[model samples]
Target: MDVKRIVLLISLALVSYLMVLQWNQDYHSPAPSVATSAPAPSVTTASSNAVEDERLHLGEAPTPAAQAASPQALIQVTTDVLDLRINPRGGDITYAALLQHKQRANTPDQPFVLLQQDNQRTYIVQSALEGLANRGRIQFQASQSQYQLQEGQDSLQLDLAATIDGIPVVKRFVFQRDSYEVKVSYLLDNTSAQALETRFIGLIKRDNSVDPSQGEALGMSAFLGAAFSSEENHYEKLEFDELRERRYLSEVQGGWVAMIQHYFVSAWIPDAQQTNLYSTRTDNQGRNIIGFKGAAQRIEAGQQAEISANLYLGPKIQSRLEAAAPYLELTVDFGWLWFIAQPLFWLLDLLHDFLGNWGWAIIVLTLLIKLAFFQLSATAYRSMANMRKVGPKLQQLKEQYGDDRQKMSQAMMELYRKEKINPMGGCLPILVQMPVFIALYWMLMESVELRHAPFMLWIDDLSMKDPYFVLPILMGASMFVQQLLNPTPPDPMQAKIMKMLPIIFTFFFLWFPSGLVLYWVVNNVLSIAQQWVITRQIEQQGTS
Candidate 1:
């Protein structure tokens, strides 16, 4: 393959894989098919007294269960400041491993057994939940007073008293809004004096879906017991009765990570050990799919053991994820070329600053890149140029050694030696830049910023193919011109196949994002212009 064609193939394959990984992780939708999706309000508490600076502290956010919603099928519930998420139908979630709790609004009443699903991406704004649910209490006295959301406070601390066994169990859950970290503090006011043993497991879970038979949709992981039926490729919207969704895992064992459709996920840990966790699901029948039942946990008496965890529910921005945890971000699963995918994003961000528009940014960036490699390209061109210059003599040698492969091979090497031409002059630059070019292509496909971004006239979205295919046609034309200028190989069949490369690439580029095509077009044009200059210089040198 010619240098350009090889780069194009690598770029296409890598881009496709990147998109698939994001689709599975729900990190991004390829072309921004949904436009009205609003930027979510700050999921944080007001800490910076400055009105303009939206500062939120760790102790000021809400839990994950206080909101309700459906994105056409997207489940989002906002109570006070709580943002709750429901896993889509056929998605993976369990009932037992969920953090389910209910609470009343007034006077610091504690929460009850509010249900929780698995890997759901919902959030709870403490104040919002208090106001919206109005007292999410069950068989308990729950009410709220002295609720004031100051515009610039870091956290809203409140006292909670739950009457479990005819005794008031007082605890404090510090809800930090901005950072989404809820700190739970328990005041062991048991007065037993001897010692009291208890377990304090923090709760967070996905919501149940309309469908109950075959839980949330494709690519989600769920386990069925020995008697349970297999659920595969059976999730369809708008069912006659109700949709089946994974309720909650009864227990989570070893390691656990919940997957939400194109949203967010979390891995639950128990004291950072290899202990087993049980799981279950709540069907419409509310039949529990308990994968693990009666799991064991221990708590010491008299002294206090507290639990804390960090929840990440924003867009699955890779850098933010990396900051959150390692191997945590790799859950997105970019293909074998992830090395290229990572750096491509870095390069795109840098180029975007210079060009302003990401589409134009890609174009200018590719052009500059092509120019930077002009020395190598010039070398490649010079190889072809010198080859063409010796064409007449080469043909005369072939004619003399007709039908003899050894004679032609010897004659060819002799000619190259006499002319001091390197047979593989263009190889190094082509191989060196191949990874970078492919990675950039994948970045354009993977980045959320490029979704719905527009190029010049008639081209609206840079992350999608040009609507009219104008850019692809022009890209093909440029490649064809460059191909015409390339050194013609001796074999006629090889020459024919090379001649068809431009057309093949044009079709391939047609389905790619516009930013990618823009890169190719600019590179091809530069190559053509450079070829003209190099060929002209070679002609002059030969004549001299």
Candidate 2:
């Protein structure tokens, strides 16, 4: 009936929603296996040939020692946006760093490493041929180890050559300037007397290491495992622990499999024209592998066949991901309410483009959201205003019905009925807006554009918490002011707890992303302005 009850209901609703999310993360069942019109080969069958099985098992040969044997063995390729290392042993991308994204806010020189193969952790992209034969250890030889994109160069190409069963195979990686997508093509010049039946396999293998890209403590857990796009589902998350239970197998056309962390992702997108077999399994060393095997291509004697797929290894930029493959932008993972979140982000980005500052954009977005919900908020404020106007009557009833619980409730209900007030009107409107608020929270937390994005003075990175807790303090102050505008609860205990809501929320928000906190602060300020005006208007009319 009063501000305290509304606040309590909102708190309970938020907590219940978060608990549901956590529950889904822990115990959510996996989707049923998706099958295409044509049957794709199984993992074992894909590598069924004895010769292919020996060489195709990924993460096996190119031991850390072998990969670390010499710098010459690792080919370094640098583009405008990417710095990557290719191991010549199996033509796998051993290391990939985003040249444009910093690892930490304070360290501008250190780039964020997305994939690495060192003693500390093993997360790398690998490619293997599934039907090749006659191989001791396929060692690729590069023309030159270090390749850099020149100032005028728009693209760079690095080719690693190896011979398998007298066939010359060239693993070519093409990198474009200012782009994170790499075209990995395996060119097989089959000069043997027999036809070669081989499938191109692309795998992303990584250990269960904590995501280094995760920001501040006590934040919502970002998905830290594998995901894929299928014809049936646009995006499906496959947690690392889920892979341990049973391998994920799906056959689909025009799909991609990726390893996603907080702000970064690496996906292998096969050709969209053919059916691909996608699977996930833990290797011998307890590393999770999610990859796809393209349809088998038959290369006749003395014929040349080129099998290629696109590798996206960089920050999860929605535009870039969408350009790389269909439904790849869903990797942004804005939760279940993406339909709402998507438009919210679009508007936010548009505001950013106009304002040229993320902080200002957030404030303006909050104002716009408030305006859109003006009618709903007005209904709530009017209800609270009416309740405040009858404060003395409620107090009188409490005093007259002291220590008599039934009489007190009856008096309150009768008074509400006479006043034509709905006790639930204030809470229901807010409960309706809870989903949008949560969606915005996820959008802000998961947006790579906001990472290290500066606002104005004192707020250097919107993705991180406020360094000095200034915004959170201001947020608490705004909430306190809002409480002042609304009628206090008649119950003593309820009033006490309601008074503490601001402080409690302030502490919880101390660790949240500054961008999200900014939104809340602005929303609260706007609500205070609106409620103050309505309460004054209602009071003046009542007095008159």
lDDT of every predicted structure (CA atoms): 0.46, 0.82
The positional error of residue 154 in candidate 1, measured at the CA in angstroms, is: 7.4
How many angstroms is residue 416 displaced in model 1 relative to the true structure, after the best TM-score fit? 1.9
Q: Using Cα atoms with residue i matched to residue i, what is each candidate's TM-score against the true structure? A: 0.57, 0.91
lDDT by residue (1-544, candidate 2, tens digit) is 4453766666666755664543444345244232222122233222223223322354344445664535566889999999898878778788999989999888999999999988767899988777552243368899888999999999999988888768899989999989999999999998999898988889898887777887553246788889989778889987876776656677778799999999999999999998788887765566777888888899999999899999999999898999999999999999889898999999999999899998899999999999999999999999999988888999999999998878888889899999998877777788778888888888887899999999989899998889999998999999999989888889888889779888877876776778888999999999999999999999999989
Candidate 1: tens digits of C-alpha lDDT, residues 262-304: 2233333233232323333222232222221112223334444
Please give the TM-score that candidate 1 achieves against the real structure. 0.57
Best by TM-score: 2
Best by lDDT: 2
The TM-score measured for candidate 2 stands at: 0.91
The candidate 1 region of ten consecutive residues with least summed lDDT is 226-235
* Candidate 1, RMSD to the unseen true structure: 14.4
